[model samples]
Target: MSSSFEFTSENQDRFSQILSRYPYKRAAMLPTLHLAHQQNGYISPEVEQYVAGLLEVSLVDVREILTFYTLFFQRPMGRHHIRLCKSISCWIRKADRIEEYLVERLGVASGEITKNGNFSWEAVPDCLGACELAPMMQLDKDYHGPLTPDKVDQILEVVSDSDSKV
Candidate 1:
């Protein structure tokens, strides 16, 4: 394997163990994809190709898994992810309105990257396991809920400040 492309013996072993968990290797697709994404900040074609080769599967097989998962970033993303939930409970509490407020207030719409590369906004149309914390969004993997435009501004400040350290 090329220097940049090598999957270490340990990683390969772990992957093998993960595959063994399932009766079929194909059933282990999500775990395999999650491993690829965890190693890298986001899913890249190179990772997909490597995993495909390791599993003796086609590249399309790998690509399909990456594309199917919303958490998997098909392209590189900013340091922080702003996922505004639009699920039913959140919607009743103004999740969509908060989304609108953020777009108007923060000047970035869902699925768009900011000019500063510090943020990426997306509208998540499902429960984030915290319907009680409706009108919420996750920033930098941290959940902030029952939101208002002001709270989003606070989160943006915090995320931007933290990004400089990384």
Candidate 2:
């Protein structure tokens, strides 16, 4: 693993502020990991070492937390990370169709990035806590639900256009 990780000055200050909120440095692990992810887009082995050093915790402790959280990506993600809920609520609502449509439309299998690096998708086993809006998928931080192929196309078009501008 690479050992050249170093948080930026601003992130270091942010880390200090986050650490101050907790009684122990180890308690600040989650937010510290978030800062690292924001900097590097994914938690690599180097990031685990960097975070372990910052929190004065064992690398194993940091790795355990990283592996346990679905939100933390060990590998790089595309501009959009799409998570389709595969829990009971969503499954009964025919979330499978939504997944299939996305796979066909994006030309990538689940948990794979698109050719243009615009999108990555996965079916998550956890409930997204929006059962009322079943068959829901989260694109980045926002939830869209009761999804139809038409809606999926619209969402992809908007995201694609937005990405082009950037």
Candidate 3:
């Protein structure tokens, strides 16, 4: 139910720095959205409005950029975001079965958040740029590869355990 979103003081400084790099305010859209996402976790409608106001652009303009980019998250995506590669290389490596395992193990369909609010996942149809690590997934910011159900279990276990410690 929490609603307020703004850059922290440090991020406000960073935002100022970001603005300085662009010749025009509108040119700063991507980096500004990235800053907002880093600080707020996701880009909500309020954020679109806020950014639009900041850059002196229309809300439609901000939204168009947001929707066009796959990396920008439009909703809360839990503490961990898992991107499973379903590209040709990964699919050939039995990534389909791995996706099935994730659905079964997480008790949620792809693109759904886990009930516990700790994880959300999506199957990416495009390459994750680690073809050598076929059957790979990007968990948060790290890529784990050559996955089997066992490796997936271990990865989830490690992340879950770390979450508990924090």
- Against the true structure, whose lDDT is highest? 3
RMSD of each: 3.4, 1.6, 2.6
**Which candidate would rank higher by lDDT, 1 or 2?**
2
Model 3 lDDT per residue over 19-95, tens place? 99999999999999999988878999888878888899998999899989988899999789999999999999999
Give me the runs in candidate 3 sitting further than 4 Å from their true place. 1-4
Query: Which pairs of residues collide in candidate 1?
Result: none
Model 2 lDDT per residue over 68-99, tens place? 98899999888799999999999999999998
User: By TM-score, how accurate is candidate 3?
Assistant: 0.91
lDDT of each: 0.78, 0.91, 0.92
lDDT of 2: 0.91
Name the runs in model 1 displaced over 4 angstroms.
Answer: 1-32
Per-residue error at 123 for model 1, in Å? 0.7
